[model samples]
Target: MSDDLTTLHDDGVLEIPISLESAGNSLDGDSIRNGTDALHEVMRGHRKARAVLLVGKGKNFCAGGNVAHFGGADDRRQFLRGLAHDLNTFTDALYATQLPTAAAVSGWAAGAGMSLALHADFAVGEPGTRLRPAYPGIGLSPDGGMSWLLPRIVGLGRARTILMRDEVLNAQTALDLALLSELVDADQVYTRAREIAADLANGPTGAYAAIRRLLMTTYSNTLSEHVIAEADAIADLSITGEGVEGVNAFLAKRAPDFPSARN
Candidate 1:
């Protein structure tokens, strides 16, 4: 738990830990920039890693933008643009990552905090964890792909209610609504997430990335266009060496060599 916003570690398993501790008392201004920079560096260094596991220390996952740093900017337009840019950078990095990713939430995930958790491929929270979309509550709108991700996860009506009402959804309720991928005891959150990450690390990495590509394309694609895109992907994959190895492995009743992924 360093004063820096993020801590990176490799734990023998292919997945690495991207710990979000704190930058002092509050996440105020410049914290998001610092955090994102650190995360970018971590990602660059671990290009071969299979997954990212996000964990937080202290009472909450994050309390959103530092209010102390909010109103001081002289140019309102510049400030808003900077905020949007940073959020998009952070989320794009997360979503475009080749490996699987998971968030282990042990405490409160509020505002952009919830957005960060939602960005993960899978979110695992502790039993008593609380998640609040703190956007509308503070007269601010959603960012960090919240508008794009939330409705897809929980449907339009539920997403609207959560955003408009600013309700605090607990971990259990989050799981019930399909907003969370799993729930575990508070102390076991990171452990369970790590286990799952390890499993994904050892699984079909290329196939998982292909699935991610399809889902991302589906976001703005028409049905007919998506069908054409899918056909292209299927044809491309069929010619790939890994795809051939996978088919051979299945027929031979053996594990896939994934020769293309060999380091």
Candidate 2:
């Protein structure tokens, strides 16, 4: 755990909770940079985690960007550049990670905060939680991969309606719109996400990574290119220790032990 308020707990499952002193519990420069760095450290490097469960502390999962720090100055530009670099690095690392990721939202997730939650493989929000896009309200556009991910999750028309209107979508509506995978009780947000992460961690790591890669590359790959990629992925997975264990475990009717291997 870091003194900045973000807590990382390991209890048979890895849990990363975002707690900040900014609006909507959103991450500011210090919070985002420090928390992202700390997560890489705790996970023992980028993409090393078997699974990740992202949660929020207190009431809101996140409210969005910290407007208090927004200003125009040389110092501000430098800060903004550094912040963008670090965040993009962290986000890219997370996206490239070999593990399954889940977001557990408790209350309000607006603006960039909602974008962060949407990045997860599975998004779980409480019934009373609110999901909104507040960028247009502030005369700004989307960031934090929101522009790319929003349209993919919800169609272009629906995404435009949400972002343009800056409307608040409740948990059930978000679920109906495919913004969330499940609607859970507020109290069970973290617990349920942890369980989901644990389930993924217990599965085949290499195969999971291949699946993630496939999904990520789908948008850019041509039909012929995708076929080649699929073949490459299958061939790559067949040689890993995980592939061997997967087959053995199935034949033996026993659980596989995917202990960490140091090269």
How high is the CA lDDT of each candidate model?
0.69, 0.73
Best by lDDT: 2
Q: Global CA lDDT of candidate 2, please?
A: 0.73
Poorest stretch of ten by lDDT in candidate 2: 5-14
Q: Which lDDT value does model 2 have at 40? A: 67
The TM-score leader among the candidates is 2
Candidate 1: stretches off by over 4 Å: 1-46, 71-77, 257-263
User: For model 2, what is the alpha-carbon lDDT of residue 57?
Assistant: 65
TM-score, every prediction? 0.82, 0.85
Model 1 Cα lDDT, one tens digit per residue, 1-263:
23354444343233322223464222333555655565565568743455666655555566665554567778866886787787777666665566677777768777777887887788888778888888786688887787778898888998999999998998889889876799887778878877877766666666777778888778699999999988887777776777777788899998886735443
Error of 1 at 194 (Å): 1.6
